[model samples]
Structures are given as C-alpha cells and as structure tokens.
Target chain A: MTWIMAALLVVVVFAGIGITKWMNSTATENANENWRDIAQAEIANSMVMLEEPDLSEPQADYYEGRIAIAEHRLANDIPSFEYASMQQQVIDTHMMMSLVTLLAVIMAGGIVASEFSQGTIKMLLTRPVKRWKILTSKYITVLLFAVVLTVILLISTALAGLLFFGISDGTLLVWNGSEVSETSFWLEALKLAALKFSSVWMISTFAFMLSTVFRSSSLAIGLSIFLMFTGIQAVFLLQNYEIVKYYLFTHTDLTQFFTGNFMISDITIQMSIVVLAVYFLVFMAISYWTFGRRDITA
Target chain B: MAEQAIVQIKNLSKTIGKKKIIKNLSLDLHKGEITGFLGPNGAGKTTTIRMMVGLMRPTEGEVWIDGQSVQADFEGSIQKVGVIVENPEMYKYMSGYKNLLHFSRMHKGISKERIDEVVKQVGMQNRINEKVASYSLGMRQRLGLAQALLHDPKFLILDEPTNGLDPAGIREFRIYLQKIAKENGVAIFVSSHLLSEIELLCDRIAIIQNGELIDIKNVNDLQKSRYYIQAEPLELAGEVLTGIGFPAVLHDKGYLIDSGAEHIPGAINLLVGAGVRIFAVQPYRETLESQFLEMTGGGEIAQTHTK
Candidate 1:
C-alpha cells in the first residue's frame, strides 16, 4: 500500500511539473514578440544615452562600451532567453526536490517515533507479534511515505517545468554559470530523489534507534532532526576528525551522488551504500535489543 | 482430567541496578485455575508477571510456558500467553473491534468468529464498535482483556486487572475472569494489590514483598486457618476469652481468635459461666488482605522492587 502511494505521488508530481512547464511555455510564446520588441527599444535607448554622456574621456569610453554590451545582449534571439528560463526552471526543480526530501525525512521520523513517544508502541508490541516484526512494519510504512512524498515533489516540479518551458528533445541550457545537461538534468533529478529517499531513510533509522532507546517519540524526532541538519557541520568542525565522515548523518545527503560530486576523496556509491547499510543494521539491532529487553510494566 | 502446568517459574531472580526486584521466586500456574499474584505497591508483583509473559527476562531464573522456556523461545511462549501489563494500552484512534482485529491478525490461525466470541465474553459486545478513545477506563480495561483473549490463549496474565475499577466493575471483572478460567480451562495468573478481589476470585495466591516470595497458598486453605471470633461487649471479651483458656484479641466489636469451631462451644460455655453474654458467636473467614499483610510483614517493605 505504501509503495503504491509513493508511485501515485510520483506520477502526480511529474504531471504537476509537466503542466506548470507547459503553462509557462505557452505564456512565454504569447509574449515572445513583445518581449523582443521591448529589448530592442531598450538597446536603442541605451545607444542614445551613450551619445549624450557628459564627456570625461574615460567616462565616455565606459558609456560607449556599456551601449555595445546592451546591443549584443539584445541581439540574442528569444529562443536563447527561453532557454535561460528553462535552465532556471531546472535549478528551481532541484531546490524543490531538496525541500521535498527534507519533508519526507520529517514525516518518516514522526511515524514510529511519535507512536513510541505517545506510549502507543506498547499497544503494538504487546500484541503477540515479535518486536522485530513491529519495527519492520513501522520501517516499511515510513519508507512508503518517504517514497511517495519524494515522487510527488519530483513529478510536480517536472510538470511545472514542462508547463512553463515547452517539452523539447534538446540539450539542457545552463545559465547562472552552472554546468548542467538536459539528459543529466532529469536523470540527476531522479537520482537526487533517490538520494533524498536514502537520506530520509537514514534519518528515520536514527529516529527509530532513538525511539527504541528513549521510548519517547518527541525526543527521538527532535534529536534526530537536530542531528540531521547540524551533525554534519559539527563533524566538519572537529579538528583531526578521521572517522567522523563515516558517521551515517555525514553521508545522509545523496546530492553529491546525483551531482557527480564528492565531498571526501574516497567516497563512492558503493561506499555510501555500505555505510548506509551498516548504519541501518546497527540502528535496527539496537532498537531490537532495547525493545526486546525492556520491562513493559508501564 | 490431565493435570497440566501451563506456566512454571523456577528460582527466578531479577535485579535492576543494585535493587533486587524478584528474589528466588518460583511458582507454578496450573491449567484451569485462577492464581492471584498479591503484593502491596512496588512488591515485585508487576515484575514477576512481566517476566512470566516474556516482557522482561529474569536475571537468574527460567520461565517456561507450555513446556517452552520464555528466554529460549519468547515468541513461542508469548503466542500461548495472553497478557495485560498494568494499564493495557490500545490504539485510541481505532475502534475496540479494530483493536481486537489488529491483535488477532498477529497470531496465526485465529478466526474472526473467535474474536467476536471473546469480545462478547468480556461483556463489551455492544460497545465493541465504539472508538477506544471514547471508552471509559473500565471499558478500556474490558477491551484490553478482549484483545488479550482474541487468540484464545491457553494462559492469561493480567497485571492489576482491577486497578481503577469501581466496586461494580471490579465485581463484574472477577465474575468474568472466573467464568473464563472455569469454562475455557485457561490458566490465569493475575497480579493486583487488591486482596479482597483476589480472595473472591483466585483459587491460589502468591504473596510477594520487597522482591521476595513471602508465601504461596491455596485461598481456601488460608481462609480456613485464620478466623475472627465475635462476642458481646468486645472490650471485656479479650480478658473473658483468656480466662476461658481461649486467647483472643479484641478487634472491631469482636475478638480475633486463632482457634476454630472445636474451641468455640467451650469458649461460649465459659463466657456464659462468667456472666458475660455471648451475643454473637461468628467464625470469620480470613480475608486475603490480612493474609497478604501477614505474609509480607504487615506491608512494611517498599513495593517498588521491580527488577
């Protein structure tokens, strides 16, 4: 059921992004000629202003150079402008994805941990089921919510991008001095979403471990979230920190993977996977041990 | 009838930090009997119950249910044991029936019909559809019991089952517990500080105090040995009875005597001879409260010794 919700949410997000991009593209097309004319008029006015400059020889030279720059900027066609807009949309999509990932982590962090804090975990645990099964069920539920939420954000951003910028099989245009490719843009977006999902899982795992340890949902949630944002920074500040990079929270952000970037020299996808797997197992083991041994007299 | 032991705790000892909660506690809960675990507050009653149900492991003992050790096979032992630890918590958002259904699904081979049967048995048939949040404390307790009984477990362990219950509710709970034990032949091990309820319900009782097993006795046998004798003019009755060679302590308009019916007639004759009216010659059955107090040294030990 959770997986299905995730899939549906992903579809909805993509459709939303597509629709938004489509709408923006249509609006751009409608105002294309007017925008071109406006640019031309502005360039002409700049040329006239340069001719009337109060002449200090260097100032006149600088004014003439500015007019030439304005003319060159205006000579670029509307297509280039539209392409720049598309590039901005991709960046905006990436930002939205990051926001969505954070939201997913928060949601997953609350699911099981909240139950523990509220003392509702007693209800689940006392029911003839093994403690591990209860934890697994909660873990699965959180994963489902995370996947669904991320997919929805991704799809929505994509739909919005498609609606504003017409869908065309062309190379992605990069503005703002950032190197990005269209093929890489969508693929990276998907990978970024996956990374966010993994990061959120890591956060949820931490929350689960804390939930089991403290048996308080709010405490686990608060601590996990605080660590999620600040833990990396704290680890970075530590002088001669050799093993801090291996900390699960340090590798929680999968953006580096999607962006083909590495914060540490030896980090790789396999390494990240191994690190995450270890953290995941350790958290589960601790949770199981604590829960299994707890005296449920309360 | 095959005499089967459903639960057996052997030399169980538990210590949390430096304080020992359960000390060399050994007990046997036989099939088709209601055994009460009696103690004052923090008397290790809850601790012993939790260990039996596999909620907490004993530090130096073994708990076996249906021939399987709880530590060795917790899942197997727990599957056969229905438990309500302290105030049993249920999902407040879910309906009473839904809670039962949720628990029922966890145990393999339990049918929906059995769930409905147990709900009705616990006398919550009409209110089973109501959300648990809306239920009163007593109602929630009934629902908790219903959920515990969903899989028709062979052994039932309830901690403070009558806690927070009114007089009427407590009476109702006792009756239902008796019925369940007798009708289903389910072995019941219930823990509570209320001795009166235990006296009325349990066939046997284990008294614990300060993490020590003070005594375990048949309720009937405990009642038989202890008696309260009533006579007219209770203030002078203690001296009068002592004069008649039957020592009695004046207590609440009566004299508590360790002696039984064999000495009652002789004492009555002697009282009449001394010009004292034998207004009432009543034999008092031992209340569980008195027995518990006697076993635990008048409840002096702290009840918080749960390891």
Candidate 2:
C-alpha cells in the first residue's frame, strides 16, 4: 500500500508538471489570438483607445484589458509575456488541491477497510493496545498522509508554475463582494490551501468513518468518492427545505464557511463548524462503538 | 485446575444477530502448559479463543489474563497475552524484520535484541530480511510466532496454528511451542478442529461441542487403554480373566479386556493357567477422533472418523 501510494504520488506530480507546461503554452497562444481579434475589432469600429473602454462582451473586455497591459509592458521594453503575477501562480497551482484531496479521500477509505479485507485487523486488534488507540493511530496517519500529499502538491505545483510562468510581484486578490482587497501572496495561498484541506480532511474523516463500518475497500472508496463528487449537488437540489442545512454534506466543505459562500442563508460559519464538530464526534463514536465492541470473527 | 492461571475465560457467550456462536463456555489456561482446544465444525473453538483474546467480545462474562480483565483494561490484560487467531496475517509489502519492528512500536521496550532473539527462536533468521509475500506458509507461520513472542508474553493463544503445515513443519512448530511454554513459562492455548494434531501437540485437551465445553482431560487420561487377548477356550479364558479382576469380555477368538500394555503378561499367565492357549494379543486405545465423534454426537466429523 505504501509503495502504491508513493508510485501514485510520483505519477501525479510528473503528470501535473507535463500538463502545466502544455497549458501554459496554449494559454499564451489563446491570449495572443484574443488580443489580435480585439485589435481588429477596434480597427473596424475606428474607435480611439480610452482609459476606461466600454464593451458589451465581458470576456472580450477582460481580454482587452490584458492586451492593453501587455502592450504597455512591451512599450516599456519588457521582453517576456510569460511573466505571471503571484496571483496567477495561485490560480495556476490551485487544481493541485483538488488532486491532493482526491488522493486523501481514497487513502482514508482504505484505512480500515484494507485491514479488514486483508485480515490484518486481527493482528492489530489482538495487540496490547486498545481499539481506540489503534483507530486513533490510523486516523492520525490519515491526517499525516494528507499533509504530506498537500505539501507535495504545493511544492510540485509551485515548481511547475515557476518553470512555465516566470514569477513577478503582484498582490493576492480577495473578492470582498463590494471591492477587491490585496493581501500577502504567501499568506493568502496558505489560507486557501488550509481551507481546501479542511474539506479534504472532513471528507477523509467521513471516508474513514465509512471504512470503519464497511469491510470492502472498493465499496467504501466508491461510495465515499461518489458522495464526494455528487454530495453538494444533491444537497443543493434539496436545500430549499430548512432542515437540509443540517445534513452532513452541507457542512463537509468547511471551505464554504471561510469563503462566505453559504449553502443555506442562515447557516453561519460558526454554525457549520459546530455541526461538523458534532459530526466528527458522531463519526468517532460510531467507529468506537462498532470497532471496539463488535466481534472480529473475520 | 488450581495451578497458576494465565487466562481464565468465564461464562463466555457470543451471539451474532440472534444466532449464538458460543454458549456459556468457560475454560482456564495455566502457566507452563500447552492446552489444545478441539471441536467439530462450527463448535465454537475459534469463537472461544477469539473471546479469550479480545478479538471478539463475549455476550456475557469476561476474560481475565494475569488478573486483569480484558473488558475493563484491554491493553493491560492483553499485554501478557500473545495470539495468532487464525493464519497469522501481516503486511506483505514489508520485510519480515520490518513487520516485526512495526508491531514492536506498539509495546514499549521491545528491544532490538528481543526482535533478533525472537527471529532466531522462530528460525526465520535467514528469511527475516525478505518480504513476507515471498515466504512459504510455514515461514509465515514462523514469522507470526516471532511477532507473537517478541514481547515475551506470559500467555500465548493460537487458533488453528497448524492448518497449512506439512508433517515436518507441524513437528517443528510443536517443538517450538513446547519450548516456549517450558522455557519462558508461557501458557499456550492452541485450538484445532484436527484431532490428531491436537493429540501430538497438547499436554491437556479441551473438547467443546456446540458452543459448550464437553471435556478437559490430560492426554494420558484421554481414555482407558483397552486390549484384546485372544486365546483358545475363549469362554474359559474370559471367565479366568474376570475371576482375576481383569473384567474381560468374550470376543472374537478370545476376550477383550481393558488394561494397559504393562498388565498383558499377568492376563496371559492367568489365561494359560485356565488351560487356554493364547493366540494373539493386540492393543486398542481410544483415539481423539473417536472421542471427538462421541462428543459432537456423530456430527460433521463423523465421516472423517468413521473412514
């Protein structure tokens, strides 16, 4: 299992690096094409460039701004178009969080189920240790694995991004609903990774709890990952009912609370935290009761 | 029964979803002894061992190892116990040595010397560095013993330890278990559905049938040794044997009598005095298979025994 996970991590990081390089080249070409199209449109309309240009197409307007900025930098004799602001690095590297979480969820689902499937739980349970300690050791191992994956994700993506897009000083942008705010790039990225990890950890805990209840790794991983992908959509479809806010999937993505994206209007971040805490305790309780008290006939 | 008790299972009952697996079973294991558990299929031998080792919880009652209740303090109670509930499972991805090292982390002060000692004790020194996936069944069993003995446990529980072993491997395993029990003062509780294996391995045999303990007897006392002393004038020979307190019954060509091998000469002399010419003297001792059949009441294992 350890070797498999290591092999998977290596494959994923190299794949991420390969894709990042391809994506960077394609993105630059696409941006240049969009810039040329804008220039042709302006020439056709015979309009003067304005400090604040009016455009009906939101995408076109955004591209026009980038083109203008590029022209200004070029006029200033800047040689590189691949110079990405720190904020762009954050954006370019953000997909890694999703990949790391997927890995974390799979690892979590395998924790107890693998032991049961392989019949290794007998050896573990027979040891001179309480079931709770054994369980806690597995849970802590999950968290550590998640942390390790996240760190690999962070480092690998950072290197990939730096290799593809030259780093430049820029503000980390935060949308305040009324205006954008500037923040330290590293701190903001850290906050985003931490928030993303909160969701991963919660989903992992859910999978870990499922692992305790189920004997098949495939069943647990399949169900947990299924719920992971479709849970929010299912919750959203039923969210009109006030009681749906208390559902587990509604609060699993603790990032929603930090991002101020409320699944329910009245479900505050603190309330979500409390709900998740209650769920965490409940997951642990079920694991304790089932794993500790139940017979291990297998 | 009053000897130093290493494990005491009291009224152990296990029911899973309304079907009772073990019913009101109680047994004791003493220090410095190898006790074999025997039963027919689904007779709860493994269930009882599971309950004893805290792998399965008893419906009512508790297992006390070294005076600490497994229910109340699992760690403290099981600390003195080493168990191989079934085929010993391990992380196949790890070397046997690394596997031992990993399990040693759970218990404090399980030294490097202890690990090496157990490795040598189980005779896995050469193969300890190889991944467990590469080991044979006997080697895996030995590695399992190495892991079980790493802590120098006072009590050892093995549920069907010889399931896949060859004859020579089984002999070696028995020798190691006997050595552990005698030299380390570790009480060993081994269980098997195979009666013959139990016969050769244990000092005392515990027979359980249908979730109940049927008998616990010393190997020497499994049954009274019975012999057939055939001779001419069978009726007179039977009478002469009975008159002399041999309690012989008339049989094919002569008589059947219950006596150890040592008493054959006296019986033969008494029959000759009665002018009965002895033809043949053959010994018959009750086997574990027959006893198991009688205890299980001619159930699943009867086919094997009768054949």
Candidate 3:
C-alpha cells in the first residue's frame, strides 16, 4: 500500500508539472518575442544615423519611456516565468513530505498502540520475553517501516520530476540560494529526501513514544499531527520573545540547508544532528521509563 | 495436602483510591493442591489474586511464589507462576496456536512439543488454527489457561476461570484443573464465587470477604461441622431432644436433631416409643452453600449460582 500510494503521488506531481510547464511556455514565449521586436526597431533606428530623430518633446519622451519599459520587461520576464514552475515544485515537495510523514506516523503508532487498544498487550506482556525486549522489537519495526516509506517517496518524486521536465544540464536552482549541478541534482535530492525522512522518523518516534505511553493509537496519531502543524509555531512564539531556540521543534525545518537560511548564527549540520539526537533520546527515555513502571493490568 | 508450599502471601494489602480491596490477606497454596479462593463479588478475591501474580503490587506486605518474593524478584517469581487475571486479553487477530507460540518464545527452553502439549491439554488442539476473534468466550478462557501454562510453571493462578462457562464447560474445566494438579504437581490457586463449583473442584478452600481472609478450611473439615439430622418425630421428640441437652429444630415431616453419635440410638428409641411413626433417620452434611454463607458473614452471593 505504501509503495502504491507513493507511485500514485509521483504520477500526480508529474501531471501537475506538465500542465504548469505548458501554460508558462506559451505566455513566456509571446512576451519574449514582443520585447525582441521592440529591441530590433531601436537598433534599426540607431543604424540609420537619420537626422537625430527629433520630434515634439512629448513624443520623444513617450518613445524613451516605451524603450525603458520594454527593456525592464525583457530583463525580468524569464525568471518570473520560471518562478511559477518553481513555486509549484516547492508546494509539491511539501505535499509529498506531509504524506510520507503521515504514513510513518500511522505505521509506527499502529505497531504498538494497536496491541494495547485491542487488549492484546496482556498476552504479549505475559510471555517469557523481557518487557524491554518487546518494546525494542516494536521500535525497530517502526524504524524499518519509516525508512522504506521514505525511500519509496524519494524514488517516486525523482521519476515523476524527470518525466515532466525536459532534461536540461543546468544546475538545479533552489530558493535564491543553494545550487546543485545537473549531474549531482538527483543525488542531492536523494540526500535531502533522506534527511527529510529522518525528520519524519523523528516525528514517528515521538508518536510511537506517545502511543506507548497513552496506549491509544488514535490519540497518538492525533497528537502527532497536531504537533507537526503547531510545533514550529509554538517554538517561534517562544523564541521570538527572547527565549532560547534549544526547543527541538524550533530547529526541525531542514529547509534552512536547502534554502540558505539559518535560524541561528553558526548553525551547522552537526548542530541539527545533535539537537535531534537529544530530542529522540529524551522522548524514548520517558516512554521506556513510563512503560517499565506501568502496571499492565489495564 | 502435599507438604511443600508453592505460593504464599503474608500480610498482603492493596488499596485503590481510598478503598481497601485486599487487606492483610495471608494464604498458602501447597504443591499439587487445587485450592479454591472462594468469595462473593467485590470480596477482594481478584485483587488478592492479582497481587499474588505480580500484576498489581501490594500496597503493604509480601507475596512469595516458589520461595521468591514477587516484588523483589518479580520476573523470576512470575516465571514460575502462571496467571489468568479476570478476562485474559489475547491477540484476537492471531491464531490460537500462534498466540501460544508467541508467548512460548518469551520463556527460554520452551519447545514446539511443549506448545503442542499445552494446546492439547486445553482440548484446543483441533481448533487451535482458528483466530481468537472466532473463539467463544469459553475457548478464549481455555486459551488463556494454555498460555498461562506454557512455561510449565509450578504454580497456576486463575481468577474466575469458569466465570462465563456453561455447565458442561465448567465441568470439563474442573476436571482439567484436577488432572493438571494431580498429574503435573502444579499448585492451582483459583478464585471463584461459585461455592458449589469450588466444593466440587478444590481440595482445600479459602474464604475472603472485604479484603480479609475469613477462613481457610479443608472441604471435609467444613463439611463435618454441621449436619441435617432427619428422623421420625416423637410426640415429645422436639422437647425430649432439647431436654436431653441437644437442640433440635422441628421440620414439617420430622425433627432435625443435633445429637452426638452415641446419643442417636437413645433419641431413636425414645421417638419410637412416643407413638410417632419412626421410619427413617438420615444425617446430612453441611452443604457448601451454607458453609460459604457462614464463612463470609451472610453476604449476598451473586444470582448466577442458579444458572
């Protein structure tokens, strides 16, 4: 099911890119041709060396304003056209991330929480296996699922993106900032996708911990989604008021690496790794401690 | 009545939210003994059993299984104690056999043969392939017992093992418990409010009420304490029995005389001479129902006893 959904998402994204490209090609080509015609007329008049084309002052001024306007349009038109396609790609990327994150959360939440919700934890807990081992097994299963799901999403996005846009050897342009060569674009995207996957995994782990603690799959899923949407906002509200940015969610957006934006000075990839590792450990620690001490009679 | 104690609780107490559910409860279950933990509803029977199985820790005191404290060495103690507290929750999506297999993996050294043995022991060998969702409540209970017995634990703690069983199911379960205790030497500590069922199944009985141990007695000992003596009525049999220093209650057909064996003949002779038809003399041992009522201070037994 996960692989199938990922394939479908790729198809939809490629279809969207195809339509955007077609629409912008026509608009941009017409605008470019119109400006080129004006530039040709100005060059022709300059070559003639005709008696300095004197005219009534207002008429001369009008032609000068027209030339300035056309030059400005010629300079900025192509980028504006490209920006339309880029914006759509950004939206698609975010949408894919959201879908992948949702799937990861559900998979992780279901692995353990389903047992508790269905009252099967009693039988499982009573077995000869140590309680810690049982929890560890479930955690590993969720992590594996997250990895597989992320890989599928990344592969699908690349396949769809290539099919929609004609192959060009130009560097992949990201928001006004970071650049990647055509040869490295796919690989870089894979790396970014994997990092994005880790972010999803982080969320899934948080949900898994909540699932273990609350023993309700629905509650865990709901809380996870709510946190995903509101977490950054809450962190920003706190950080904006002179609070430290040490909160885990405050640094969750990995776009800073792709967009050349940084929330703090001297922010490095290693710092992000450290912050996430600490967050993951703290979440897991609380979950294990609570589960170890809980009475399973419930 | 074997000598070795398999499970023992001393001064155990458990309170939940201001209500004392099990209070200073002490009891010993011997090896190879099918001891019935008999009590009425809300009598703290399940609470005491839960504490014994380490499902719930006692707020005060100790529980020892196989000579180890349940609190200090919970995993070790639990390894030797098999428990089915109330309704045993099982993975409904998994096959009954798979459930057993899953639980079997938890205890080291459990073989495939042992899993099969327990499945057969519970009489679920034929239907073990079916998912637990398709199992009847009786089957689920049997499966629960099978899982509990998976590791071949020395002590078995079952709370209301036959709570929702039909008559035949209950009978079959009782026989199974007896066979396990006698054949395997497993100490069976079972709790139920069914006095008649306990009377039939358990060798020894413990009565608990409102978190307190009211009495622990051998079935035979309790049976001997009271008897219904029915005999032909003498014209003055009621007065004559009382005058002879034995109290007698008058029934519709005859007098229920409470007299020693030695005095029976005298009462019989006197009743015959009083011109009353002297047809029969029968001694009735105390029924478990009356014994339960007496032990638990006349609390209301649940109505399911009739069903």
Q: Quote the true-contact fraction of every model.
A: 0.47, 0.85, 0.42
Q: What would the per-residue lDDT of candidate 3 be over residues B91-111, giving only the tens digit for each residue?
A: 887899988888777787889
> How many angstroms is residue B139 displaced in model 1 relative to the true structure, after the best TM-score fit?
0.8
Candidate 3: clashing residue pairs, number: 3
Q: Where is model 2 more than 4 Å wrong at Cα?
A: A1-83, A91-96, A172-183, A254-267, B223-226, B231-238, B249-253, B256-267, B275-277, B302-307
Evaluate candidate 1 by giving its C-alpha RMSD to the native, one decimal.
10.0
In terms of lDDT, which candidate is strongest?
2
Docking class of 3: acceptable
Q: Sort the predicted structures by DockQ, highest score first.
A: 2, 1, 3
Looking at chain B only, the TM-scores across the models are 0.81, 0.90, 0.85
Q: Give the worst 10-residue stretch by lDDT in candidate 3 chain B.
A: B225-234
Candidate 2's residue-wise lDDT over B119-217, tens digit each? 988888988999999999888888888888888899998877876778988899988888888888889998886788889888999888888888898
Better of 1 and 2 by lDDT: 2
Q: Candidate 3 — which pairs collide?
A: A128-B106, A128-B107, A129-B106
Better of 2 and 3 by lDDT: 2
- How does chain B of model 1 score on TM-score? 0.81
Error of 1 at B41 (Å): 1.1
CA lDDT of every candidate = 0.70, 0.76, 0.71
| DockQ head-to-head 1 vs 3, winner | 1
Clashing pairs in 2: none
